[model samples]
Target: MKKLVLFLTVALMALPLKVKADEGMWFLMFIERLNHRDMQKMGLQLTAEEIYSINNNSLKDAIVQFDGGCTAEIISKEGLILTNHHCGYDKIAELSTPQDDILTNGFWAKSKAEERAPKNISVRFFVRMDDVTKRILGVTNPNMTEAEREKAIKAEIAKIEQENNEGGKYTVSVRPFFQGNEYYYFVYQDFEDVRLVGTPPNAIGKFGGDTDNWEWPRHTGDFSLFRVYTDKDGNPAPYSPDNIPMSPKHHLPVATSGIKEGDFSMILGYPGRTNRWMPAQGIEQNVSFAYPAWVEGSRLGMDVMKKYMDQNDEVRLNYASKYASVANYWKNRQGMIDALKAHKTVEKKTKEEKDFNKWANKKENKATYGKVIEDINAYYAATNEKSRHDNYLMTILRTSDMGALPYSLGSAFSQYMEASPEQRAEMKPYLVNGINESYATLALPLEQEMLAKQLQLYATKSTGFDIAPYVKEIGSKSNNDFTAYINNAFANSIFASEEKAMAFLENPNADVLNNDELFKLSSDLIRQYNTVPENVKTLQNDYQKSYRLLVDGLRKANPDKKYYPDANSTLRLTYGKVIDLPRGNKVNDAAENWYTTLQGTIAKHKAGDEEFEVPQRLIDLYNNKDFGTYADENGVLHVNFLTDHDITGGNSGSPVLNGKGELIGLAFDGNIEAMAGDVIYDPKLQRTINVDVRYILFIIDKYAGATNLIEEMTLVK
Candidate 1:
């Protein structure tokens, strides 16, 4: 296969002597061969084996993929887990009620018996990973079409996963890398009985909120604590009274010695996705078309949700996690758009493509490497409008529970209707419970407004493309106004209320669902969103082929440069040092600018302000200088710090380790100056914003007075 040849061609080349330490999300399996020496030179004290060892307890064993989204690390022998507060926001919100609004006031389990377990929360410990590129490539050839090649590779991957899973003892995943030129299978052990131990109040945990999210000199105490439980035999199990805290293979020791400029810092975690290898045309499409629609759609959803949220404490608790999620990405997309344009990223990628094209078109390379850029450019040109249209509809489904009911609940209802009586009996409880849960958190007025506004937004913005047919009909008849139509539909539809829905479940009917106006609207939107013209599918496939070749060609063209695969939620390591950026007229000085102290936090406080309000207790403590031992040598409690370590979305909550593999900080956010870091790493400007470990300790020990938690941890002074 051409892809196989491409993989081999790059593999056969000698490894580069050195690589920029701050730039890569590197695979653990290749660390010794590819990066160990460079890392040692950059002050990494751990051996490669100590960093990632399949044969022994190592740093990898302490890190976990929290809820399949963020990273968390083991901090105690009793399975104490430390992760970003935002990472645990959903579970915290789920466990919150108006009477006991722990999400707003914060929660702490003084004893293990008080720890609350939220349903469906789990953490995955990375066991090991191995490259299977050659095996995956062995099944297909150059003449095979993309579809055929994918089918063949998937079949082999299934076998590989089955073989490694050890009879369901582990969760095994085989993932494609470098645009499918390589493959690797990762093994993990999942613990389902995770329980929340403690969290600071919203005013503390989410101090700066959206206003300071991606900004530097941040003062957010973005950390939460949970504990993992296991069966008596130390095997993963569901929650039980008899279960005990897990004794993890390894746990990071907490470091309170403090940090300074140029101190070694490292992060090991799962970074979700990065399109660093994307072509110039793809970047242009995202910046100019796709992201703008996403930003607008997300903001509409946030506005609708926030209006209801602010009206009642219960509503706020119910929508807290959802609102935070939408708001975060809404800001991120806008920042990405600004950063991409400001950094001239598209122009840079375009220049790189031009250089690559020159090499690819050379006589010896033309037959195999030519046409890559042409196909990529043409594909984006054809799909730009479609991408914009898709995102607009997608945001509605993402934001409005009612907008997604047809797919989520309706699909379950369909399954119930089609099942045999025995199967229906087995599934009825789950189906009924699902409907009850959906309506419990959903405010009818809020859902109606969200769906109507999102549909209106979609109908108005997605011009030149066919809007969802039912939505279009309503919009046209009402001059793009969905208020009346949506109100009438909610008044009549069974899905709008639990009583109406349960009544329908007593005697489910296909005709009732088929003729429902709300159902029709949702069904139409889903259908249109999913259906792609065959010509467009062809273009997408061609784009995939060309993109793969482009990545491969770039590697071949630059054989002297080291290449690391883009992140796809797999465990990876990135290392660097404490770093600072020049701000306005100030020189880049870490001692003055690398970290934000609690004093700065109080300085920014605006009384009664939602995002900037400081808790009275915290303010009093700061005024009294009651920081105790959590303060630095200079007696200031640092809230957050900056590092040159590379990270992305899923890296949130990852442990920032000092040279001795001691936990010093928790990587939470990245500065806005390098929002384009997902596509291009800017060493001078891109920095990982982290919650200092001492701040976490102060919040737990002094602020919350959870000294039991302090006793559990192994603290290094």
Candidate 2:
């Protein structure tokens, strides 16, 4: 075991010390050894230690994982955070009311007292990370089944996490890299008292709406401000009046110097997930079977939600976050479908796998890797139709709150009913709180339509698999139309309304819940989703082992290629240069320009347009040339720019820094042409779209008049 670990470690270290200019999400711990010299040659001015030192303040201290899903950066000495407006959308919507609709009108905290802390939102600062590969692999032998190996690893990980968590002061995560061939544990300190400081109106924050999402030459002011608060001693604490703005170890300096094409740029953030090492068959499964179902199901939910959201402000507020999430993924999946097919991704991967198979068939290597490719291909081929069927049902649970309630809140209520009087007394308040919270975001009419339409789609689209039995029974009784059945279910089920739910809670009855239509359907759907055949389970276990071996074997086979692990919601650095794509008639801008400015934004404005409406104040400021000192040397305010830095979903709100490690922009989106980037990095087409820092300042100081925020930041003139 020791020899194997040593060999693996030595192989990884001995790989040619090279760095791709704009393609890899690199681990910070190895940067000094693998990337520092190349980075300096390209234009980096900061030492590698200055970027990720644990003994001293470094750039990593300012970067945080925002609310677990996005990235954010500390931009002021007082721990002011800067992130994409969309990343902050849920909190903004939660803080808004019809009378004080910050989601529509925008918000600026004139004083710290006015900043609002939304519940369950927290920022996690990376404390440190280190390799744990040897410790993890020490417990398992090559002969162990995948399931046994996973159990052994989980036990080892728990011990490691307990040892490094500093007695619960830090959140510890042991993440697999190179498809479970290597392991690294990250330590994070979570600050729960993050508060909203400022944001632009939806008209500016989401200027292009669905039509312009993922496209280039964007003018969206996609930035928001927040602040992290701590106890007086600068320790993490829950929200309280006594808590003070945190004094962070480091905060980024805002660079007033504008960027240009071919200038060096770097992004540091927690990018969610990428399947860059996926096999050819896996790519086929996603593009052909899985994503189409997801796209269709998402569109159905969006259409239903948007109809009611358009009619009432309250409904819109409740559904804003949900709707945005579905809509974004709907477009993204469709784009992935088109992009994957257009780029011939599966074909490319197939060729690579063929080469790998040729190398693996050698007599010396045959025993280990001989069956790996065949097993992976067979598993995916067997599951393609099942994958399509599963995604359709999964989409319902993802999109509709009611569709998931039975397994979540409804199941809890059942347990509460069965509990002893003393236990019930203790659980009742929590149950009521859960009910109220779920109902707060639940719009019955919208949910009903969404549930009904999704059921219809699932019944018709899921051709090979048996859907939930209750759903099929309902369909049969209603002549395959689910509207009347769902309407009747909603009318009669206690889960349908807060009033009925409260009444039921007052006098709990198991029989009543058991007989309820909505509960029965939800339970049935969840049960079907969870149930897997024994054969499929065995195949899955086999596939897992083969996949891990494939990754390890690939590395051993190819020693000269610069390999980096796929992104897995860990802090990573990707450096590149500002770059441009040909305009190609899609954007009404100069063909050679890499950035969009206020003039082009005004040109696209339309009065009363949901997507293109420009705020009068913004137009007035533009007309008056009130860009202040935020404008470029050309005297124009750049709204957004492009960089060829590798990034994906969770990289939104990541600080785009210059060579000096100064904040230049916030990465918010990627070009539509490179939608396949999550699966494969394309150097020629992939571009990271960033909201310019100058534009962020212009909105705060000139447009919104939040100079209080400006005064807090350290700026480079």
Candidate 3:
């Protein structure tokens, strides 16, 4: 039985350490060893089933879709819920007023009545999906012409949907995972009453803030709490005073005595994206050029934004989010590059690729397999040319000057330049077919301003041939200093870079700004982008195509492998018994991992510090027997749980469950070393950072003294 399972795994998976479209080379084996199962066992996962049964009395009525975003499992008979702190940032930020800094001070429901309302926050659940893979692929045989297969599959999916009855509130989403290796259908139940329940101040929740972001051996307490509500009829509704808490099937017990290193664990939530199956060349390009270049460019741009934001409070407020987003991705890319350099993930992968290809060729699997891999690699290589299409198509990497004028122009012409044929069907009259919408989003000169800052930052931070030499070499474009040139561009450009534009914005003399037809046109373009986000539609279609190719291919070749498609932003079951990955010996005198300890924080604390010190509650908990149960190898309470769970940004609110499928921790950030997994998933290095349920419970009971919230749930000490 083990051999059979092993064979099936190696014959069908995207292994953590390999790139086989039809096998789990190493990852599948690893997961199997952890006693993890695929979708077949998903139905048998009682916790998951219990979650499903909450919305309805039967699993049959509980719909789970793959396309669903913001995954939420029913936690209690009354709709009290759980998710990550960062996931609720937008809602918290929205509800916070100028005088009330919920982000900094944090907010907890004093009682049920104190849960703050957020207009835009939402929670969604998977409803259902009809496995239409056979119908989808039936029209396109592996032997069929590519064009013929494409047409047939399209017709088939449409037909399937047309024939099936869909719940009015539900929507069908087809996602591509493992590149173009697979596809799956997801149905979802979206609710609008998500509210902020509790969040630690940024000092703790986002401890170390951006500087510590995307880093590992991390100490960030990245959990924020929220609650879900439903209409009186027990359905999703926009937030209203009349709305009440949602009814859930279960609320996880707070495991005060937390997990041991080798215990069973699982993370169930919406993981954004993972590229564990890219060909070697793709890896090379990323490590050598793509990631490094993007990181450098982003760092420069961020420097500029920081300067302006620091000096101007209004500017800071407006751009804090924008800064975090770019910085977040930049941090991830840098981490990946660093980790790739630190270890031999790329080398091992390359070696494995060679072995797989050699074996497949001997088995006569090469003729077709060889060409496909070759095509993907060659196309990837060709597209990544430094100054050409591959990595430099937009010049956005090397040059971050994002002026509004250019963007406005790009958005205007994009009506004709909009790229996707399918997306073209839904394009606004002002949109260009091939042009990117962001080009016009900066018509307000947002890009140019962003670029100006980027250039200034590069000028200051970089040296050698990379940036310093370039600035020095520009020598003076048109009798102006770089800064002056930038100012002129924003002030003079037709993309509304003048005093009049600002004056109009301040008071609103749109008639003057739009006296010309061109102004009217640009206004319409901006309006459309703000309203529809049309580009999303086109991108979605491409993913659908990519998904179909990948999943359909695997289904045809490995039907008996018990495949679980790559995760869509939906509720997924990825189970694994926890395992410790020791990178190296603690330098005889030093600790191997930088955990959040009283000693570490106390030593680091200083007078008049910019960041806050560790909360006293933690110190008291450590000194007293206040800690309920969790402890590390040294018997110090492991206030946090960490693991190499395959995860990403969107997995923020994900619930890290024990083998019993009870929530043990809330999935938040990845350790600094694990950032590379954002671009490259190296099981040995990438880890998910979670707040130990015990620490949280202790903080609530012994620290914050919030016994009411603690008493509401079953906490197993």
Candidate 4:
């Protein structure tokens, strides 16, 4: 049984990652969330036999993957899909200029032809996912110990093919969780082109901005509308004049009712990773070092984005997604840090450890738990030095240092070089024009600020680097003087100088043959910079292995228990009833109200302040309808809902459906209280925020008067 548990831990925790902390009592919660057959009869859900089949083969081909790259819920008979406004903001924003702002004013086509093309946006539906886990893992023995287990798994994956992924819709991977406690597999389809649909201005889509990001009882209209399209016959294809909307048979109806507290809800979409079962030391790294650096870095980035965007409308428009993306994590990280601090996650783990030890000491329970807890800690401790600076810096290094410069150059340089004289003018209004636009000016400043913060944190917290003295030297040099100096330099950067910026921006046909200096330099730097340090990569890879080992162990021990894998950017389902859970006792939290209401919003309102004042647009929208769409018993507008659906990054556009499969709300963001929810998934803390669907309709119906959009939705109400 002991060995059984160890294997189970690794197996179960291995897949798209299972058991974010919220998965506690998951088996019970999922079972509780399960609608009885009679209930299913009314709700239009799978019957028992169907449910059996569905559960047996979650990877089967009932679901469709969006080919062009955005997550969408097919909500209409004619392929009306629902996704976040921000998700499609870019297409809409790009379509609009100073003369037309779809982002601010919004857009709705009066008819099908008028729906307007969204440049290159597309969607995909998965045909199938195979459980190659048994086969994938079959290369190794279940009986193999740690080192031997590692070697076999590597050999197996090596034989699985690395290069010719052309036929691989997406790599389907099987993963273990909790030291091999259980395992699961994921299926995905990737697309490079996606476009915008409709979006409310930032004032609505991100109403409260950074101030209100992760709070509950908050009213913010975070939903946007988008539709996935493809070629006429419904197969994935590049953009062309003759393309048509995707016609999906499994489309959701738009009129699903809103959920009240305790209504069971399910989220269906891709999720990223979570580390729910880390040891005390691992939690310490997250709480003290990692969380702080991330929060600080995000705040710094926000500072840079806000300063530049505030100054330039073009900058704001260009980096709309960038701001929201960073803010998303910013709000959550702060919330998570606060919640974990208040909850004393380490304390909980400590108590858990004590209990486990008690069981381990007992003759019967000893084998099952044994030194598993200790080993988890030991492995995690080894990563501490790397986790500090490397954790935060590495993420930015890949995204900014590596991906940014070259893209900026390419954007400014190569597109229109070969365009025929007339075609150059034609391409100007589209993607080519954006080349002259200096997003690097906007993005790099923000990253530079973030890097400054990270280096400081690294100097303050990280250890064992012989660069200890160099780290300190670098840290002190990066203070205000350094920032000002760098800003001055960046402000006058070659890209910042419009002489060059415009030269690249205006030339629709500036051709670069094999010898463009900037292009070659960029190419060389990208190669030189992106190479992860051998030591760091080795540590990260080993960490991943040990992490999987733990997961595999858990799966073997708890075969009877339902276990889900951690997310690895693949579709998954987490079912639970909507219920408000207590979060921070410090800032402001309540028992019955999981949602932050207008009352709470009002409490935090900065009446005289410019930065935090409620947007007049929101106030007018509120006044016009007086909580126009829906209201809680207290009569305050309810902006979001609280749920235990385990989620992460790719789960962004998921529709949070009730037991009856009604589209009550669109899951957009999570409350700040559970930012730590990603790593620790604390059920008592994390809550999924949703923009009430009815509010979206009311905005369109009452304010925007875009009746066409209103007409498109199949309203259940």
What TM-score does candidate 3 get on C-alpha atoms? Answer: 0.72
Off by over 4 Å in 1: 1-18, 585-591
Per-residue lDDT of model 3, residues 407-461, tens digit only = 4543433443434656544553333321333332222334456554544443443
Better of 1 and 3 by TM-score: 1
lDDT at residue 497 of model 2 (Cα atoms): 88
Pull out the clashing pairs in model 2: none
Which candidate has the highest lDDT of all?
Answer: 2
The segments of candidate 4 whose C-alpha lies over 4 angstroms from its true place after superposition are 1-45, 48-71, 89-99, 116-122, 141-195, 256-259, 350-376, 395-546, 557-560, 581-639, 681-685
Candidates in descending TM-score order: 2, 1, 4, 3
Q: Please, what is the whole-model Cα lDDT of each candidate in the order they appear?
A: 0.87, 0.88, 0.50, 0.54
Q: Whole-model lDDT, candidate 4? A: 0.54
Q: Which of candidates 2 and 4 reaches a greater lDDT?
A: 2
Residue-wise lDDT of candidate 1 within 1-717, one digit each (tens)?
Answer: 000000001111111113588888899988899888988888889999999999999999999999988999999999999999999988999999999989889998999999999999999999999989999999989788789988999999999999999999999999888788888899999999999999999998888888887887788999899999999999999999899999999999999999998998899998887777777888899998888998999999999999999998888988888888888888888999999999998998899789889999999889878999999898889878987888898899878989878556776777789999999999999988998788888888899999989988999999957788888888999989899999999999878889988888889998888788877888888898888878788987887787778777877878887788887789999999998776855332235888888888888899999899999999999999999898888788888888998888899899999989999999999988889887888888999999999999999999999999999999999
* Alpha-carbon lDDT of model 1: 0.87
Q: If both were scored by lDDT, which would come out higher, candidate 2 or candidate 3? A: 2
What ranking of all candidate models by lDDT puts the best one first?
2, 1, 4, 3
RMSD after Cα superposition, model 1: 4.4
What tens digits encode model 2's per-residue C-alpha lDDT throughout 336-423?
A: 9999999999998899889989988999999999899999998988888888888999889888888988667678988998899999
Instruction: Write the number of the candidate with greater lDDT, choosing between 1 and 2.
Output: 2
Q: Give the winner by TM-score.
A: 2
